[model samples]
Target: MSTIEDAAVWLAAADPDPIHARRWIGSARIILLPLGERWSAVKVSEHQGLAAAAALRGPSIHDPSGQCVYFLVAPHTVWDAPGSECLGESYWLTVPTPAVKEPPGPYWLRAPDGSGQLVDAEELRAQLGARSVSAAGAASVKQP
Candidate 1:
């Protein structure tokens, strides 16, 4: 429902740690799976094993090229004390990436509020989606 820019602002206001700034600024390859008549996006990590686990659990197709949409995430963190920090709220800024290829089915983006948006393949294509890069390359591609 909100634009990626909006998500960025929200992330910035939430977590302002400079160390995580680099990883949090770019787009993430989200794997989307077909659900009944719509598609739902799956959140994955940089770890291939973890991604595979997520794919298996979601029963979603895992594309070797992990490309999907760009999202700015303000990692969930908690402050144990004044100078100590732990993990807190999880928030992400989701935006469509036109330079990548659209998945076979519709894709969804979940807002920080927990609501989801369903986008059709055609609409994704019209945006000129980008190609996603797989973390493990050809060797990591799996069929499930």
Candidate 2:
């Protein structure tokens, strides 16, 4: 199977309606992590979120509202970034099939790439902190 197909299968394993039909695309699933808790996510503002994802070079999902982004992180990560919220157990994420790459709805900014890659929580925290400081400094500057 191709990489994306593999990713599709991997992700679809979480579908609660598995017995109804094996959907490969054109639908989304409300899922916990597959493979005994494989990942978690951090939700942040699109501004800093995209920048952090670019810096970290990891997969992220851009929310339909375009105001926020969800950065996928390794399972059991302790994420306490000031401006971001960690999504874990008891939290369900709506994930579109691997084939959906753009919106009207949530889609990948950086797609999974079939590598099972996830962002490092510490690096994401640092990047967000630096950006927040920069933004705060810019906002506080008085007009000359």
Candidate 3:
């Protein structure tokens, strides 16, 4: 975040549920942006008031939990700048965090010729669980 207050503003504006906000906003940023665009995110610390924003660099690789993981090349810098640094944290919201009971956002799959098709959330949950889809909008996952 640019200013300390900006972080607060972001937190305030996000969904009331912290976990939901993280998943929804985070997923939105991941799926909507260009396949390889990187971004900075100030991860709000549940234990504390604030922590430095991580690079949140992505379209990288998906984490084991099916959440896409990125490097927080540096901290305190939320503005997007090429080659910036951010802080990466694996202890998101502290472990044992509740799995998002709701769908993060709409999931899209790419077709053979390069077309994006929207898919249902249930379909997404199954595919993600199976790790069957390689890349979003990259290929279909058995067309079911």
Candidate 4:
């Protein structure tokens, strides 16, 4: 098999139910961390999200309905940020399968390229904080 396909298969090993109808589903193999007890997510708008993903140069997921992007981090990762969502153990994030890279549904903005690469929690927190500060500054500026 090709490298990407092999990587996809390797990544999919995290699937709790590989046989399930939906190729995409919740995975427990890697912990999503950032400002939480265990799993946390930093949601960013479409444009900013894309930029952040590019800046990080790591795996990220895009949710069309939510109009945001998510960067999956390592199990041991952690960060403290205001808007971050702390997901409990029961919370199962629906992720796209190896083949589902693009979206009509939740899809990978930056799929794992078989390097076992994930977003760094510290880097993500910094990006979010910087964006938040910039947004606040813009909002507080007086209209001419």
For this target, which candidate reaches the highest lDDT against the unseen true structure?
Answer: 2
Ten-residue region with minimum lDDT total, candidate 3: 108-117
Q: Give per-model TM-scores.
A: 0.21, 0.82, 0.17, 0.72
Error of 1 at 56 (Å): 27
Instruction: Give per-residue CA lDDT, model 1, range 19-84, as digits (tens).
Output: 253244344433211222222233332243223332221112223344423222222311122211
C-alpha lDDT of all candidate models, in order:
0.30, 0.72, 0.26, 0.62
By TM-score, how accurate is candidate 4? 0.72
Residue 53, model 4, lDDT:
81
User: Which of the predicted structures, 1 or 3, would earn the higher lDDT when compared with the native?
Assistant: 1
Write the candidate numbers in order of decreasing TM-score.
2, 4, 1, 3
Cα lDDT for residue 32, candidate 2? 32
For this target, which candidate reaches the highest TM-score against the unseen true structure? 2
lDDT measured at residue 141 in model 2 versus the true structure, 0 to 100: 98
- Residue 138, candidate 1: alpha-carbon lDDT: 50
Scanning candidate 2 in windows of ten residues, the lowest lDDT window is: 27-36
Please estimate how well model 1 matches the true structure, expressed as its whole-model Cα lDDT: 0.30
User: lDDT ranking from best to worst?
Assistant: 2, 4, 1, 3
